[model samples]
Structures are given as C-alpha cells and as structure tokens.
Target: MAVLSLKKSNLPSVWLFSFQVIFLALFVGLKFQTGYDWPIYEAHYAAIQRGESFYLDFEFGYEWIVQVASRVGLAFEQFSAVVSVLEVAFIAIAVRHFFPRYCLVVMAVMYSVPDFYLIPTFSLLRQGLAVSIFLIGVCKVFSGKKISGLVYFTIACSLHYSVIGGVFLLGLVYIFPLSRMTFSLIFAAAVVLYVASFDIIRGVVEVLIVYVDPKYMIYLDRDVFNASFAYRAAFAVVSLVIFTCIYSAWMRRESSDGDHFDRGFGLLSYRLALLGVLIPLIIFGFPTLSTRYQYFFAIFVIGCSLGALQYVNYASRIMVVAVIAVTAYLPFYRFLSSPLSIVYIPYQSQLFYDQTNSTGHDRTNDLLNQLDVLWSK
Candidate 1:
C-alpha cells in the first residue's frame, strides 16, 4: 500500500518533468523567431560583441550575458537561444511547489504568460528574464525564505528597473496584512475613482510616472475604451472569480487545520495579484505603462490557484479549477482570432529562414506577401 501511494505521487512528478523538458526543447530548438523586437535585440547583442558603448539602451544584467557569450566565442543567436531556455527553467523553479499537472495545464492554455508560446513572448527579452527571477523570489518568500527571495528580487532589479514595480507590490503585501473585506472596500473606492473626471485620473497617472524614469512619459497616453463591451465584461467576470478563490482561501484557513495548504503565501501573493489586476483595470484607463504589471500579477495568481487547490475539498476544487480554466481561456481565444493571421500568417521561424535563405529567396518579401493575403480579397 505504501509503495502504491508512492507510485501515484511519483507519476505526476514524472509527467511534470516531461512537460518541462518538452517546453525547454521546443523553445531552445528555435534559432530565430519573428517577434517584433527580435531585430532590436539582435542589433543590441551585436553592439555588445563589438565592445561598443550600448548600455544606455539596455540594463547591465542583460548586457552581461551577451558579453559572456561574446568572450566564449558564441554568436549572439546561439546565446539568445540558450538564454531563452534558461528563463523557462527559472519559471519552472518558481512554480515548483504547484502540482506539476496543474502548472503544465495552465502553461499550455495561458498565452498571456510572457514565455508561453506566442510572438509576444519573444518580444520581451530583458523584462522576461527579470520577471522569471521575481516570480521565483516571490514563491521563495512565500515558502519562508525571506532572505533568498530578497536576493532574487535584487537580481531581478539588476536585469530591469521595471521590476521595481513588482518589488513595490511585494513590499505592500508585507506592510498591509489584507482581508477580503479590505479588497472589497478598495475595489469600491476604485470604481468611484474610475467615474471621476479624466483630469483627476491623469493627475494620478502623472504622480505614478514620477516614481519611474521620466523617459517613460513617451509611453503614457490617455486610456481609451477601445474594446467591445463583451471584452470589458470578461475582465469583470474573471476578476470576480479570482476574488472568490482568494476569499475562499481565507475561509479555508479559518476552518481547516491549515497543513494541507500554504495559505500565508497564497494570501500574500493573492493580495498582490488582486491589486495588480485591479489597478490596471480600475485606474489606468489604458494598459500602456501599467500593462507590464500584468505578468507579475499572473504569476501570483498561479501561485494562489495552485496553493489553494492543495487544501480545498473536492467540491471546492471543482469551482477553483473551473474558474482558472475559464479565466485563462478569454485572453488566449482573443490572441488566436486577432490579426495574428496577418503577423504570424505562415508562422515563420529559423527553420523557414534557413531553408529560404539557402535558396536565395527574399525572406522579408515572403513575410510581407503572406500578410498581404489577409488584406486582399
């Protein structure tokens, strides 16, 4: 009987390991991808190899990796390929505590996750690395490794200053031990604030910009309700489900022995996730500068969702999984049916580039003509 129990537990772990390995292989096998920022990152890495003074455009931590690759006599392409795999490894470590099956399911379905399969995934190089580290750090903090988590957070900041926003959110988690009622009241105030005049909201955004680089002023714009009502309604529905999962967690702590789940971290991460998701929807009318916070927000939600699952009764488990699955599906469906049929029409990759380049075909024109088809009758 003991051996049988062990076998059951080990089966999921083995499957989880296989899932991680497959993801690493798929991402690393790519020699090139067509994210909009690929050319920019390609140029930046070349400048580093040439020993040009190019640190102003990128952070030192990112440049440091390119420099090491240069010294090791590897091309920027090879280095970037390997580093992409490493970032995924970091995320795996970050969510190691979650039931591997659930984590794999989420990763497979959730395109919003920066590293998940998508063109946008490749667009963020430095920021993606920073987010990977910060996620692991938050998980570590939740697991009671405060010092280790702080070290990871510091490393994240070194990679990209934007991670400061994540750090600030974590700090708030520690400062304010929150409750469901607190979140409720806060959301109420946010709606009130949302109804206020644009001048007032713009002033709030202005105050926020002061905390970051003034150069970001270039990205800030007045928020617009550009999406259909259905899209907006989806956001509200998802938010409510997340709030319910989190609030139910508080109830679980009060009723159960608390050994089956790690509510402390679940609560901390959920509070951060809630605020992260809420502020962007409530206050920042447009997801310009504030949009980056969504990645950080998503990580903690994964943490909370998985952590809560470990403890909830069978019936509660049904609701939690259902909520997570539906909430994740919304953004993913939007991605596939969007203009991607234009940008990623042929889903070109390094393999295509190699084959076509060998034949002396103009790859740029090929991509353009593919996109042109979507526009033409």
Candidate 2:
C-alpha cells in the first residue's frame, strides 16, 4: 500500500499524504464541537438534493463524481463525508506526485485557508466535488498533461460555474510569459480591481434587483465576507513583489534550457496562481460580492499556493526538514487562536473554538441542527 511505502523511499509524498489524512479526518470528526461553517455546507446539501444548480456562468464537470459518491452511500452526509475525505486525499496524492518538493507547502496552503475546512464541514456536495476535480487538473498540469488538465478543469466547471475562473486562469498560462512587465500589469490591475470591487458589486446588485425582489438582497449578506480588509490587499501587493523577485532570481540561476513545456504551459499555471490572489481581493473588498468572490479565491489559492511552493528553497534535501516544519507550523500558529480558529475558518479549528462564547455556541448549534436535518432528509 502507498501508506506502507513511507519506510522505503523517504519521499515527501508520505508526509503530504499523512498531513491530509490527519487534517481532513480531524475536520470531519470535529464538526460539531468546532463550530465551523457547517451550516453553509448543510444548506448546500439541500440545494443539491433539490437540484438547484450552482451558478450558471460556468459548468462543473464533476457532477458525476458528486452523484456517484452520494448515491453510493445510504445517507447524504455519509456520501459528502466520503467525497470530502477523498478530495483532501486526492490533492495530497497530486502534490506528492508532481510537486514533490512542495508537497508540504500545498498542505499548508490548503489547511491555512479557513474555508477549506468550512466547505466540507456541512457537506457542500457539488462544490466539494468541483474542488476535487480542480485538484485533478492541477495534477495534470504539473505532470505535463495539458489535455488531461483541460478535461479535468472542464469537469470541475460543470460541477460549479465558479470554477470557470480556474479554467480562465489556466488558459492564461498559455498566453504571455511571466515577466516584470506582466507582473506590473497584474499588480496594477489588482489595485484597480480592489478599489473597484464596490462599484462592480453595485452594478451586479442593480442587475439582480431588476429581476428579483429587493428583499432577496439578504441572501447576499453573510459573515464570511465581513473579514475583507486592507491587510488582504497589502498581502496581495507583497505576494506580487515576492513572486516577481523569486521568478527573476530563479530565471537568472537556471543553467539549462529546462523543459520548454514546463516554462511554456507552466505560464498558465503561474497566471492561475496570480489570478487566485487578485480575484479574491475584488470579491472580498466589497461586502456585497464577498461570498461569491470567496468561492473563486478558494479555488485560486490552491493553485497559487502550489505554484508558490516551487520557487522556495526546498530544492535542496537539507532544507526539507525546515520546509515541513515551517509549512506545518505556519497554519497552526496563524490560525489556532481567537478570530483565527479553524472552527470559523475551516482547517484551523483548534484556535477557532478556543475562544468560543455563547454566540459561537449558538451558531455552531444552529449549523449542526441544519446539517442533521439535511442529512436526515
């Protein structure tokens, strides 16, 4: 078995696999006590059962994956649990297989995002499958299988239209090469998009109001989007600078032609990574577009984190220990506290529930109840 092979190769794949299993297991087991956003997932289950498709702007090709997994089990939650666990596992495998040196980094990124935990908590049926499909595409891209990557991405889009952002970003990889000028344009565009998110949201709201009643506006309101701040924007700017510098330095250090394909198709992967950061800013900067934007950001972050990990110092064997330690601890330290807990966040529950109060208790309870109802039905 792959798990037993850990004693043989000493590959980083073992570590990545171990992390996903432990983290995802904890996420599944601690749903109630942690008070993660189980309610949203629970609602998603209901939506799927009722056949209310995800946004029509794109397609999610993994509809069969969700249905098959869901149908294989006796209960909805059981199926959701199975699919969710598989997602973490699949991504883990992909990370190990393609980006071996950055395996731990991929785990760290996935776990660091609070929503990663939340999505599976209540059981987001289609979206969960969509995420899994997206990871499949990532694996394909890194493994030098562009056709398969496109197919997987298409599957993801059919499951959730939001995944179209991923497809578009992936397509960008085929366009211009990553350069100082491209970085400048991206940074400038991020700034403009961040500032204009409000206007964009207003326009969207007006368009929606024309079709639906104004009272339905409450549907757009949620706590998840409330956390958007100037710090996020600052982080984007910093990441852009860091990535640009890293790419420049890495390019300078390279001695060989390397793989024309890696550098060529890898351009799309890099673009996808950048879009992952920028799209979130536009979505979260304005409260109205926060929830929808988060979906995009979540997908984007997974790709961005994977790409970013490659440029780090882990190319040397001596740095592997430090890489694992840093990747593992970063999520725990940054997210395992009040307002940063995984309960509210997703993968960092140890912190989220630590600072729990009556309100947290009630919210958690409400979400659990809803989840139970959806599963029972």
Candidate 3:
C-alpha cells in the first residue's frame, strides 16, 4: 500500500530528486575516462598548446570555450570538473521544474548509466556544449516555449550539426499536436518500411551519405553499419513497435506540470526513434556521429526509464536496483588504487593524432599532466 501510494504521487518530490542527481555526478566523475571522444579532446587541447591561432585552426565556438578557460588561468582538469558540475546542475534544475519529486531519481539514474557518462565527455567542447544546450532546449520545449526551443536548437546546430537529431523533434512539436492513434499509425508505418523495403530508406541514406556535409558523418562508415545491418534492422523494428505502444500511452497519461502533454509526446517519439536507430548502429559497431548521437539518445533513455519506474512492479524494481548497485561499484573498484583513472584513456592502443608526430597530442598531455601534478602538489 505504501509503495503504491508513493508510485501514485505525480508531482516531483525534491528530496528524491536531489539525492539522485548528486549520486549521478559522483558516479560519472569517477568513471570520467570512459568516453571515446576523450582522445579527440586531447588532440584539440594539443592544438591550443601549440601557438596555433584557435579560431583560425578550429571552429570559433569551441575555440572560444578553450580560449576563455585558458585566459581565466583554469587548468584542463579544473575546466573538465566545472563542465561536469554545470551539466549536472543544468539538467537537475530542468528536471526539478518538471518533475520535482522524482528529479533526483532521474539525475541519479542519468549519471549511474554508462551511456550518460560517455556522451558529454566526448569531445568536451562543441559536441558536449551542444548536448548540454540540447537538454536545456528540451526543458524549454516541454514548457511549451516553441520559439525558445528553436533558438536553443539553432545554437546547438551551430556548434554541431549532428545535434540536429533534436531538430526533427522540435519541428514535429511545432507542427503536430499529440494524438495516440496517429502516433501509433506512424510508428507502424516506420516498422513496415523498415522491414519490407529498407532499400528505399537505404537509398535516401545513400544520398545523404554522398551529398550531406562531411562533419555530420564525423565517424560514420557504411561498411561498419552494414556488417550488423540485419540484426540491427530487426531490433529497430521490434523496439519501434514496443516503444511506440508504451510511450504513446505514457505521454497521454503523464500529468507533470511545466511539461506540455503534446510536447512530451513528441519528445518521447523522438527518443523512440533514436532507440530504433541505435539498435542497428550499435550492432554494426558504428556510433553514428561519434558520441553526439548516443549521448543525446541516452538522455531520453534515462528520462524515460525514471518516468517508467514510477509504475514499475516489485520484481522489475528490484532488478533495476540491482543494476544500479553493480554499476555504482564498478568505478570504486576500478579506481580505488588508481586515482589516476580519472584521466585514464579508454583506448590506449590506437593513439589519436599520434603522440610522437603530433605536437597537439604532446601539449594536450602536458596540460593534462600539469593538472594532475598541480592537484597532487
């Protein structure tokens, strides 16, 4: 009865939300070296280490972040810490406004998941900035401020066009009001298209692959995605069918204030779409758009999972609790003896920008090393 009553409570509870967000921050901070994008960041830091003009060599937006942090005399580690904290705080504030009671739980779950930790740490500049802003943009959209949402999306696109996965959602929200039947129909159509004649979709994808801007595909490879294409395609169809049914109903049922029903529906639909796409991409071992795609999608996973936990049964809830417990322990065990794991590279074999030949790589390491040395001193 008590559990049922707690589950029935709709509004966000402050205590639950606060505790969760803190847990998420600490957990991610511990496993900080796991993102694939970290190497790219190192390379960028290396560039700054050289006397190369930042805006001239790199995108102005990212250059500005690095330049400003350097001008303020902040170390790389310190800058990383600040960004992590800001990401947590920004997302927590948004969650609190929309789901106050459960915001901490959402925050905790977000950080506790490996996917969340990996995304923001990727690049640590433009992509990370876009992701952080995307979260803020999501909050604005949910609050029914369409114009604000567009502006937020535009900023993200300016930083990384790959973040435009978010734009599909924003445009949908602006154009279509929520309707259960229509959503279900569209989902069904997507599944059918995915199953019956993916060639059609593939052809369109090929066109985009050939003609679209190169930056958008950053790390995309047709050969890689094609390898596990069948399995991924099957999973995409199944996930779409399942997610469509579950999220469509949940969108209709959710009563959270500061979150418009229609907008929430669109966002969840976008999330389901992302999941549908990720299923195949992961199997193919191709992270679409590097870390940006997975990072944004993981946000939806965390949010939706927390929202679903509200109605979770005892058996499933216990399973989720177990997963969290195990994930929470991993970083502690991995890093207890090696506090240096904070900056440990996830991949050591394939060096980015080849340290010996690349001045950028050397200087980036020097900067990171300085931070470690200074902190220890």
**Top model number, TM-score:** 1
Clashing pairs in 3: 12-100, 12-101, 13-100, 13-101, 13-102, 17-104, 20-108, 46-360
Worst 10 residues of 3 by lDDT: 346-355
Q: Which stretches of model 2 miss by more than 4 angstroms? A: 1-16, 19-26, 29-73, 115-125, 141-147, 176-178, 192-264, 286-361, 364-377
Candidate 3 at residue 184, lDDT?
59
Pitting candidate 1 against candidate 2, the one with the higher lDDT is 1
Evaluate model 3: give its lDDT.
Answer: 0.52
Could you arrange the candidates by TM-score from highest to lowest? 1, 3, 2
The lDDT for every candidate, in the order shown, is: 0.60, 0.51, 0.52
TM-score of 2: 0.61
Kindly list the per-residue Cα lDDT of model 1 for residues 1-377, writing each as its tens digit. Answer: 11121222233455555565556545544646455456567777778778886645677787777788888988755776676676667766655554353555445433343324344246567777788788888778877899998999988888889889878877887788776688888766664444442325566767888797777664444233345556656656666676666666656654675655445654565677567656655645655444667676665565455545656565665666666767856755655665532333344555556643432223434545654673353
| Model 3 lDDT per residue over 181-277, tens place | 5655655665565444343434455568667776645333332233244644544544554354346436645545335643444455444434533
Candidates 1 and 3, the one with greater TM-score? 1
**For model 1, what is the error of residue 218's alpha carbon versus the real structure, in angstroms, after optimal superposition?**
1.9
